[model samples]
Structure formats: structure tokens, C-alpha cells
Target: MTGNPAHRRWLMLAIGTGGQTAMTTVLYGLPSLLPAFQREFGLSLAGAGALVSGPILGILLTMVGWGLVADRRGERFALAAGLLPAAAVLSVAAAVRGATALAVLLVLAGACGASVNSASGRLVIGWFPPHRRGIAMGVRQASQPLGVGLAAAVLPPLAEHAGLPAALGCCALLCAAVGGVVLLLAVDPPRPPETGTVRGPGPYRGGRLWRLHGAAALLCVPQFVVAGFALVFLTTARGWPAATAGTVLAVANLAGAGVRLLAGWWSDRVGSRLRPMRLLALATAAAVLLLALGAAAAPPLGTAALLLATALTVSTNGLHNTAVAEHAGPAWAGRALGVHGLGQHAAIVLVPPLTGALVTAHGFAPAYALAAVFPVAAAALLPGEPAAPAGETAAPSLDAASAAPRTPA
Candidate 1:
């Protein structure tokens, strides 16, 4: 559909959000299905926990490659290429017999799906003006929690009744459907014209990006810890039914989605993304500590704390992503975001098993208490108000080239 430029921009945002949701369904869905996998396969908590990290490991391995492809080619091509293969692999994975084979397939599928992370962010930075990008990217970032919410709401029942294959097939179907939609609708923004003069050092050649990456990695530890274990904790430790725990986690994910949007909008209004991100990191630490205390004292209180922690822990992602894109600029946004994503996914890959071991040995209290430390460290590590991009203020700069529409790359 062709229409007002604003309409097209919004449409791109919607498409990007949809693509993210579709891919993340499988990644986040694994957690919801983990209990069922454990029962069916007679697996240990740590062994079952490995499934949660497998896809993230896949994402870590290929994110940079996908980012490079998006930078060299275009966002649309990278997104479609990634989703198609991921969909195919996930479909096959649904039919695999052994847990080992299934885990391998999930990891491979995740590697393919990593394409959406960089390409989608690049699309937002390229299409939206700097002033409005925070909210737009926030809405885009909501796709992650939205996908997790969907998984928590839908996959548990499907896995319980129809079995693992049905749940996995559902993820495959979502990826394929979203991939088709992205292929039809996604259009990359025009590339900025290059000046003939020799360029200075690249965006990645700075300490700022590395600092952001480090903070993102540390902050992600709490998010993954909460997400990976919440349902299982409720079901096994607290004596709640699977469906009840899934519903609670699903509601928390939904609330987290709204918080993500607000965080993005707040960053825009404040003219500094890092400020809000830093604040959220501190809040997440407090929330997790409270959650650990509540877990030991009262189950209901602990559940409330868990919900609050989920929202606080996840609220920073959009702001962090938008800052990375703005700093990288359109030319390097893909690769830069890829690097940013690598740090976060690497944390995801590591956090699950480590947390699971803690849960297996000590209990949820120790696991959550340990998780709190990372976000506090992230808050300390976060750079103060980011330096403005060259020739522009800290508030994202909207120039003529970025504002103008051109043929998709």
C-alpha cells in the first residue's frame, strides 16, 4: 500500500513489530514448554534449562553475520532470507524424535531468525525521523514481550494437551506467516549519499558503543533469569498449576510490553536515552532483590514482586536499541545493532543454565538475589549522558537525507 509518508512509516513500524513477535515466539516459547519437556523426557532442571539457552546461542553465533548482510545489502532482503530458513527449520524440528536433535534444530533456527534483530532496527532508524524514533522503536521493541506473552498464553496449553510437536509447529507457522508479510510489505529506506572525502573512524571504533554493549549484556541477565524460570518456579516451588502460572507470566509479559513503550516515550521527552536506561537498571536491581525477599517470606508477595521485576527489567531494551541505532547512523546501524544484540543474547545464552543450577541447589531466593547484582553493575557501568553525535545534539538529529524518501536499497 502506498500513501502518506507518515502512514508508510507507521506501516513499516507495524511490520517490524510483527516480524519481531513472530521470531521471538519460539525463543521465548521454549521456557513455557520447558516443564513439559522435562516431564516427557525425564530431564534434570539444568538439562531442560539448556533448551532455553540453545536458541540464544544460535542467535549469538549469527547476529554479526546477519548485521553485516543488512549493512551491505538491505533490511528487507535480510529479514526475508532469515525468516524463511528459520521457519523451515522450526517446522522440521517439530517432528524430531530425540531431545538432542530437537535442541540442535532450535539452535539452528535461532541463528536464522537473528536476521530480524539487526535488520528490523535498521529499518526503524532509516525510516523514522530522530525525534519520533524513540516511541516507534519502543513499539517495535514491544514485539519481544508481546511474543513472550503470546507464548506463555498459548504454548503451555498446546504442549500440555497436544504435545511438544504442536507447540513447536505453531511457532513454525508464525515465522512463515510473518516472513511472507515482511517480504510483501517491507521497503528499505534510501541510503545516505557518501561524501568523496576520506571518512573518519567507524562508529564501532569508539568506547561509547562498547560501553553500551557491556551495560546491555549485564542488564539482560535479570531479564533472562526472570523469564526463564518464573513459570517453573510458580508451578514446582509454589504449588501452582501450570496454567495458572502461565497466565500470571503472560500478564506480566503484557504489562512489560506497555512499560517498554512508556520507557521509549520517556527517553524521547527527556532528550537522553541513557538516563532512563540507567534509572531502569537501578530499579531492576531493587525489584529483583525485593522479589528474592518476597519469595522467602510470602508466595503471593513473591509473585507480585516477580511481575514488577519483569516489567522493570525489560523496560530498558527499546531505549538501549534506539540509542545504539542513532549513534551508529543508518550506514552502520545494522552491524552496530548486531553487535549490541550479540552482547544481550550472549547473556541469555549463559544466564539460564547458571540460574537453573542455582535453583536446583539453593532455591529461587538465591537465584534471584544473584540475578540482582548484574543490573546494579549495569547501572554503575552505564555512561553518563551520552555525547551528542557529531554535528548534532544528544536528542536524535533529523537531517534532510534521512528525512527524504527514496527507493529501497
Candidate 2:
């Protein structure tokens, strides 16, 4: 449908948000279904943990490729290509008889679903001007927690009553529906005019991009640590009932979603993305440490700590994502976003099993304590200003512009 430019941009934002929510419902949703899988498959904590990480491992394999495709072919094509096939695979996966087969299919689905990660974000960057990007990206980032919250609220009981397949089938249906909407409505902004024949170094050659990618990866550890095990830890370690724990985590996810939007708006006000990200890293570290201490000393305190930590840890995502897109510039934004996605998904693949091992050996406290290190490292390691791409003017600062009133034209 045609509309005013501002309305069109917001529509694009809504579409991107919907697509991200659907994909992440299957991606982050896996953990909420893990307990059921553990029982059905007679799996240990680590094996069930593998089920949580398998799709991320698949995402790690293909994120960069999808980003490249988005750069060349546009966001709509990349997303449709990924989502439709991935949904089909996930739907078929639910019917598989063995956990091994299901895990394999989920991994394949993850590979396909990686299409949305870079493409959707790039769509936001393209459609919205720099002044509004932080808030737009924040709205986009909210989809993950929203998806996870949906899974937390709906999946466990559905799995308990109908079986794991039904829960999985629900995710697949949602993905398919979102895919159809994206294909019908997604429209990429016109490409900016190229300035010169001379080409600069690729995104991977830049130390700034690499640093951002690394920092994003490191910071993701705490988020994944909580997402992977929060419900299980609450039920098994703190002795809360499973349903009660699920509800708590769901509420935490909702709170985290709100924090993400706030963080994005805050970044816009601050005029620099990296500054807010570094601050968020410090907050995340403190939250993780508090969670560790609380888990050890008091169950009631620990539950509160868990929700606080979830909000702090997950809030940085939209800020970092907007930073990457801006730093990469219009030319390479898609591929750069892909590389960032690769790093984050790689962390997701590795963190669950490592944290699971720590939990099996010591407890949630040590695992969380170890997770605290990554955010501190991220804060320390994050780069200052990113270099602009060759021949391109720097984007205007939203915060600075908003502070000054415009004269009448």
C-alpha cells in the first residue's frame, strides 16, 4: 500500500519487527522447549543444551552469505528466500521421530533463517534517516525478546499437554505467516549514487568493524547465558515450580524488550552509538555479578537479580546493531551486518554448552560469574570512532540535530 513517507518508513519498521520476531521465536524459543526435549530424548543437561545451540551453529555457517546476498539483491529477496524454506524445514522437523533428526533439521532451519538477521536490519537502516535510526533499530531489536517471551508464555504448556511437536509446529506456522507478509510488502530504498571509481577496503579489513564485531560477540555471552538456562536454573536450582519459573522469565523478557527500546532512544539522544554500548557493557557486567551473588545467597533475591540482569544484558543489542549499520555505510551495510550476526551467533553456539558444563560441575553462580567477564572485556575492548567509508559524507547526528530548531524554509 502507498502512504506518506513517514508512514511508509514506520510500515517498514513494523514489517521488519514482525519478521525478526518470527525467526527469533524459533531461534531463542528452542531453550524454552528444552526441558520437554530432555525428558523425551533421555538426554543429560549438556545434550539438551545442544538442542538449544544447534540452530545457532547453523546460523553461524550462513549469516555472512545471507548478508552478501542482501547487499547485492536487496532485503526483500534475501528474507523471502530464507524464511519460506526455513519454515518448511522446521515444520517437517516437528514430525521427525528422533531427537537427532529433529536437531539436524533445526540446524538446517537456522541456516535458512539467518537470512532475516542482516536483511531486516539493513532494511531499517535504508528506510529510516540517521536521526531516527537508533529508535528504529531499537524497535527492531525488541522483536527477539518479544519472540522469546511468546515462547516462554506459550510453548512450555503446549509441549506439556500436546507434545514438543505441536509447540514447534506453532513456531513454523508463525514464521511462514511472517514470511508471506515480508514478501508482499518489503521495498528497499533506492541506492545512493556512487561517488568514485576508487574502492576502499572491504568491511573485514577495517579494525573498527572487527572490534565492534568482537565486542558484540563478547557481550552476547551474558544474554545467551540467561536465555539458555534461566528457566531451568529457576526450576532446578532455586526449586521454583516449572510453570512459575517460565512465567517469571517471560515477564523478564517483556521487561528486556522495553529496555531495548529505551536503550535505542537513549543512544539517539547521546549522539554516539559506541558510547552507549560501552556503558551498557558495564551495566551488564554489574548485573551478571549481582545475579551470581544472589543465586548463591538468596532465592528471592536471585529471581529479582535474574530479571534485572536479563534487562541489562539484552539492552545493548539494538545500539550495537545500529552502530554497525552506520559504521558500515550504505554501500556495505548488509555484509557488515552479516559479519556482526556471525559473531553473535557463534557466541550463542559456544556459550550454552560451556555454561551447561559449568552448571553441571559447580552451579549457576559460577556460570554466571564467568559470564560477567565477557561484558567487562567488551567494554574494555570496544573501539572509539569508526572511520568513514571512502568518498562518503558522514551521517548527521540525530541528537545534535534534534537539539537545534530548524528555521522556516
Candidate 3:
């Protein structure tokens, strides 16, 4: 590796991002291949949904455990350990004939892949200085949308042209390649030298971290609602063609990725993640309510609002993730992030079924109105400008930090 401190940290960040992108492709992106899954396996819509959801279920169940591993073992080990096994499982999945077996394998892969959620964020927190951490984590957080975009572009067509097995194998190959990179090149971030003094209790002992978790989880409701229903609303309610709805949403998805980076830069500029998160929560509420109004009264207005809401709803994720890690301190960052991941994933999993019922009985406007409440509540729960989190001093100038020698992982 280069001896240059700045280059070294960024290189690690890039590896972490690639690792996460691969995992997200398998965990969340496989849904893009659902039609293929249905055709090949003769699955009903419900069954296909269940199959796709298997990985999420695995993630929820095991994220905390994986986080614990990252905390104790080191980020590089946690990432490679989880990812390589996940890749192996997917490789086996490519050959599996039974739907039940495939579902089981996907769940197992998800369980293993869950390591990236906490480990990558932990890695970011460890490597980057405080001021840059926001953008660093934002870049890390962009992996999800990037992975989904990659899947949308690559997986379905690959499955169509080649076969389902080929698509699964491709996901496996991505995972394995990234895993090998992490194992060979990635280093755990340097920790502060342990003074002989014993550390205090965990961050969760305070109400602040708990409240942050609650707010973030609540925020997830609106995000998933906007994401889950936007295309459906455009196609069914606005009477647009499916392809047109999809194109608009594809653009929105790309924009959403940029929104995360901007939010991170904003937080870095302001020097506080919580303040921006609180404000973004309020912004998201307004956007969602505007969407509700448009959904009820004006087709063109609703369309615009849908796109706005999609971007706004996702704006706070990197902010919250950064806040959680900083506050938790290095000692507990992994587990704290694990808890954070669990809450967000739980919300993501539940939004579809609950909101599907709401849209069914009441229609799009009411459902969006109800969804808007979550971010409003999140805004209420967020902590105002507070003291710096444990393990983080207010950042020195970037030049000063850059001149310091790189710490060994």
C-alpha cells in the first residue's frame, strides 16, 4: 500500500464501498430478477415476494451478531468472513432446483452478508478524521443505490440472455472478488492507544442513542413508502405507461444517490450530523405531505411531489448513520451500528405489507399522508446540537490531519 495517509484511507473506503455494493446487489437487488424467479420456479407473486424477502429476514436476525464480530475481531476479518461465505452460498444457489432450498440459501447468504452493514460503517469511522467522516460515510452509504442500479442494469438481462443460474453466479462472483480484495488489501482502521484506564458503560446507557435509533427507524417508513409506491402511483393512478413510470423512477433513484452525498457534505460543513438530520426530517415531512396533496388533487402536481419526496425521504440516512457511529465511540460503534441497521431493516421489511393494505383500503393520497407522519415524528425525537460524541474531538483542519502519519490497521 502507498505510505501516503490520505491515499491509504480513501483506498480502504473504496474497498469497503465495493464490498458493500456487492452485498447490496445480492441482499436487495435480487428482486430485480423476480420475474425470472417466477418464470423458472413457477412461483406465485406472494411466493416470489417471500423469496426475495428471505435475505432481508436474514439480515434483520443476524446484523447485531455480525456487528459484534466486527467490534471484536476487526473490520477486515468481519467483512471477508461474512462475504466469502455469502458468495459460496450464492454459488450453491445457482445450482439449486427447489424453491425451498433456494430460499434457505438466500437467507443464509443474507445472514452472512449482514456483516457489511455495520463493519463498513465502523471501518469508515475508524479510518477517517471527524470532519471528513460525513462525506466518507456518505460515499459508503451510496453503495446501496449503486448496487441496486447495477443489479437493475445487469441481473435481469443477464438472466434473460444467459440463465437464472448465470445471474446468481454473477452475484456470487462479485461477492467473491470483493471479499478477496478486502482480505488482501483492506486493513482495520487504527484505534487510539488504550490507556490503562477502564472505559465507561456503552452508549446505549444514555437515552440519546436510543432516541436516535427510534427517529431513524421512523424515518425509514416514509423513505420506503416513497420508494415502494412511486412507480405504482405513476402507472396506476396517473395512467402512465409502465415504461415511462420506470424511467422517471430510474432517474429519481440516481438523484437519490446524489442527495446522500450532498447531505453528507452539508453535515460536514455544519459540523454536526444531528442538526442537519433534524432539519432534513422536517423537509421530508413537508415533501411527503405535498405528495399526498398532489396524489389527491392534481396528477401533474403529484408526479412532481413523488420525485421530490423520493429524494427528500432518503436524505437523512447517511447523516443518521454517521451520528450513530460517532456517538457510540470506537469501542461500541460496531454494535451500535448493528442496532441501527436492525431498526432500519425492520422498517424496510414491514413497510411493504402495511402500506400495501393502506393503499388498498384508502388509496394513494391517504397512504402517503399516513406515511408522512413518520418523518414528522422523527423530527420531534431528534436531539438538538449536542456535545461531540465520545472518541471524537472536534476536527482539526484537514491539512493538519493529513500530515499525520497513517496509523497501522
Candidate 4:
């Protein structure tokens, strides 16, 4: 370590967050441009949906590959390799006219941008002590909502007034700017000498990591249900105006971001990520069940229950991320985080269609009931402290350097 190591690490976290926010804004936020896409290209609703989904499809294909790169090369290298190319592809997408070409370019951009998801978390694991990792990851995880908010605020107007290319160029510029910053300022965290081989079998030697992955995937069901349909539920089923429903859900989204930070802080205070996560899983189940009951009962109760469900469902994200990285250790952290993300993304990808069908067939009450079941399943799947693997103790040695005293943050 050199002079002002704390400053350097926190600086790295900020850089990572910036990079992540840029990618997320493009990946999830670009959907704000969907109406523009439909108008300009005269595409069907399904076609426009596919265009927006291109990035996620690309993300699924490349997440673990990026993780492998980070593990073998370095976080800085992986991020640069990904972000720079992502920016380039997005710039090309901005210039393209054909819908198919634009969709392909967006997919490629997403593939490149996927690097931050795995590597940024690994960066936090390397630089921060276990005690601080929770809140740090919490702040990192909040990038998703923040990016979405940014996209919602900026993209629609940008597309409407200046046209699609201009809006996409803005997204391209963001990635390019962040890529430049990361290349200049980012540093990989110091690692323990014995932190296993890059291609080592990893923490999966035990069933704990697998259980964690499954539980995380299960938890995603409730999250996506609320995220994808809560507004529609309010507008159609409950007779709330579209603007009012959107406003309430926007507030719920903000609250969801706050809960992620709070969950992380609580995990750090309790000295265990899984415990707080388990509790949140229980809380999410209860909230979703309440939502279902409200769906079957009073409109006011249903809206309140919907807000509770939205906030609680997202609370475990930071905790799960921190726990996975800590469990996997420095050597395998990148790969482990990639797999963890893959599980959640799988659920995210599948949930909307499956749950949409459930809603159509049985209504929102049954859909809410179905969503509640996943969290209950997750709670049952979660490993208690006693079930932690014996090898878990050795992993934190990778961050022993981070145990040094320093800043108040």
C-alpha cells in the first residue's frame, strides 16, 4: 500500500460506480427510447420489445466470460476491454438505420458492458474489509436504480426532440467518458499471495455457494413481478390514473434503492450478510402475500401492499452480492459473482413472460400469490450461519490487507 490507500480505494469505488451507472443506463434505461423506436422504425410492439431486450440477451451470453477475464487478467483490464468496445458499438448503433443492425449493435454493446457487473464487485471485495463490504456493495448495487432513473429522465426527451441517434450518442458518450476515467484511475486491489489459481475449482466444492445462488434466483421472481407489473396492476385493476400510478411506483423505486443501502448497512452491523438477507426474504414473502390479499380485498390496501412488496423485494441484492464475493475469496470472486448474477438474470428474463401469463390466466391476485411463493422458497433455501463452509474462513485472508485502519466512510 502507498500513501492515502483509503483515498485510493474509495476513489476506485467511485470510478467503478460511475462505470456501472453508465452501463446500466444504457442496458436497462434505453427502453425509455422504445416509443421513439416504434415511431421511427414503424416496428411492431414485439419487435420494439426485442430491440430493447437485445442488451440483456448479450449480457447473458457474456457475463461469465467477462468474469473469467477479470479473474485471469485484472478488473481494470476487463473493464477497459468491455467498456471501450461497448462505447464503440453503441456509437455504431447510433449511426445505423436498420432495426436489425441497431439491435445487433446494442447486443454487442451489452455484451461488452457486462464486465462491470462481475469485476466491480470483485474490486470491492479486494479493496474493502468484510465489515465495510456490505454498505460498499449496497452503494454499488444502487447504481441500477440510479441508472434507470437517469435513463427515464433523460432518454425520452432526448429521443423525442433530437432523434434516436442523438439520444444513443449521448449513451455512447457516457460509456466512452467512463471508459476513459477507468483506464486512467482504476487500480486492482492487492491480493494475498496464496489466493489460489485463476482456474481453480473454486468455492463450489461445497453446496453452500450453490444454495446461495438458487436462493438468489428464487428471490428474483418477486422483484421482477413488482418491477414489471405493479404500475399496470394499479392502472388497470385498481382504476388509478396512469400518471398517479407511475408517480407512486417511482417513489417505490426510490424507496427500493434506499432499502438496498439500509440492508447492506444492517448486514455490516450484524456482521453477516446472509442473516439480514434471510430476514429480508421473509419480509418480502410477507409483503407479497399482503399484496395478494389486498388484490383480493381493498384497492387502497393493494396499493400500499404493492409499495411494500416493491421495496422489500430488492433489499437482498447488495447482501447477496457481498456474501457471494466474500464466500468465493479473491481468487474466484469474479467468477462467483458472474454466476450469481447469471442466476438472477435468468429469473429476470423468464419471470415477465411466465408471470404475465399467470396474471392473464388467473389475475393479479394469483400472480402476486405466485410471486410470494418464490420468496418463501428462497427463505427455505437460504443457508444459516451454521451451514457455512469450513473453507469460508480462509477466503477472507485475501482481504487481510484491507483490515488496515483508516477513513470514517
Highest lDDT against the true fold, candidate: 1
In order of appearance, the predictions have TM-scores of 0.96, 0.93, 0.87, 0.85
Runs off by more than 4 Å, candidate 3: 31-47, 159-166, 229-248, 357-363, 388-409
Which one wins on TM-score?
1
Show model 2 residue runs off by greater than 4 Å: 194-196, 203-206, 386-409
Please report the TM-score between candidate 3 and the true structure. Answer: 0.87
After TM-score superposition, what is the CA distance of residue 13 in candidate 4 from its true location, in Å? 1.5
Q: Which parts of model 1 are misplaced by more than 4 Å? A: 388-393, 397-400, 403-409
Better of 1 and 4 by TM-score: 1
lDDT of all predictions? 0.86, 0.84, 0.82, 0.79
> Each model's number of backbone clashes?
0, 0, 0, 0
| Model 3 lDDT per residue over 155-220, tens place | 766787898999899999999999999988998877656788988877777588888899999998
Pairwise lDDT winner, candidates 2 and 4: 2
Model 4 scores a TM of 0.85
Q: Tens-digit lDDT track for model 1 on 55-96?
A: 888999899999999998898999999998999999999898
Residue 296, candidate 4: Cα error in Å is: 5.5
Error of 1 at 57 (Å): 0.9
